[model samples]
Target: MDKSHNLERHLMSRKGEHNYSATVIWTGNSGEGTKHYRAFSRDHEITCGSKPTIKGSSDPAFRGDSSRYNPEELLLSSLSACHMLWYLHLCADSGITVSNYSDHAEGRMIETQNGSGHFEKVLLKPVVNIGTSDDKDLAKSLHDKAHSFCFIANSVNFDVRCEPEIVVG
Candidate 1:
């Protein structure tokens, strides 16, 4: 079977728009509720379809609860997960069997003197375990393709760098 035909078929199958939605309900109303900067909590709930609700808050440095997930963490998670999913798909297309995968992703943000901030870059350190040793190079190269195809990575303004470690197990 020709790989190009398979690639064309795969590309053809993805010709439609994909839509997603989520709801965030603010749970922060401390009695006084925004009466002062310190008067309210920074808690919230995130829900989408039938998925379980996620407890969310601002980063602890901003007076939010340490126990809850912050937006920055969620953004990193989205980028990591999107890249992993695309990598797995491309691996399957390239005849590489991925046995295990994990990523330790990190991002850097810079805050301006006026209180605005933006992520400057994100690093995705993926440890991918493949079923055979013959395709180690191919496995490592797939991370680049995955990063290119990742919707979340493509949507972000900062650089999403991939440093994938391929291991045969």
Candidate 2:
């Protein structure tokens, strides 16, 4: 098959719409139930079809529990996971053998004086362990392709940058 035709077919096959559903149940209502600014906790549960429930809360800065997962952390995790999945797929297709992968992602959000905030940027630091060092350059280069294909990174308005460390094991 011609390369151009194959490329076109591959691109067309990847075009589609995906839908996700989640239900957030508020478990923070104190007895007063928002009668005052501090009347309620910031705890909640996030549920999706048949999956285990996720305990959630606002950031501790907003009077939330420190032990629960926050939205900011979840968003960062989503971006990291999406990029990792894409990177693994590209690596396999490119003949790079990956043994293990991990990422430490960070995000910066600026809070306005009026209480609104938005994420300015996110940094993904992925440490990928491979079977050999021969394809180190190719492995590193796949991060860019993965970022381009990541759904969560593409959906966010802020910049999501990746700095990958390739390790041979």
Candidate 3:
């Protein structure tokens, strides 16, 4: 069996149905339940199995706590994380030898006059450091494939663009 054939088989084996679940517990009672729109807090906690609970709140623009993680930020984070994970896996399979990877991701949302809004896009700026033997062009080209395979990016309606800077050390 050839290396390419083994890699193809491994990749194919990774494809299948997956199920995810999360529990969101609202923690913002403040002694009053949604008696009025302005009467309750918008704080909550998101837990998934044994992982650390993520403290979440509505965007500060919606009268939520500015110190907590907001849904919008989480959405952007999901996209960025999904892309980075896929990129790293693809790099490993392609022998890119990544030493370090970091992303400064940003997202844009446009709110309408009626208090409705939608994400316009997300830009992922990944600074990747690879081994000296790795092909920089190949590393750069892998981002497009990574974006295509990213579960979060595929599920989103807005654009998720990856502008990666590959540095060979």
Model 1 pairs in collision: none
Give the residue spans of candidate 2 off by over 4 A: 1-11
Candidate 3 per-residue lDDT, tens place, 1-169, comes to 7544676799798889989999999999877799889989999999999999999999988989999999999999999899999999888878889999999999999998998999999999999999998999999999998998899999989888989999999
Cα lDDT tens digits for candidate 1, 34-98: 99999999999999998999999999989989999999999999999999999998888888999
lDDT of each: 0.92, 0.91, 0.92
- Across residues 19-96, which tens digit of lDDT does each residue of candidate 2 receive? 889999999988998899899999999999999999999999999899999999999999999999989988877778
Write the number of the candidate with greater TM-score, choosing between 1 and 2.
1
RMSD of model 1, in Å? Answer: 1.2
Error of 1 at 58 (Å): 0.5
Candidate 2 vs. true structure, TM-score:
0.92
Worst 10 residues of 1 by lDDT: 1-10
TM-scores of the candidates are 0.95, 0.92, 0.93
Q: How accurate is candidate 1 locally (lDDT)?
A: 0.92
User: What TM-score does model 1 achieve against the real structure?
Assistant: 0.95
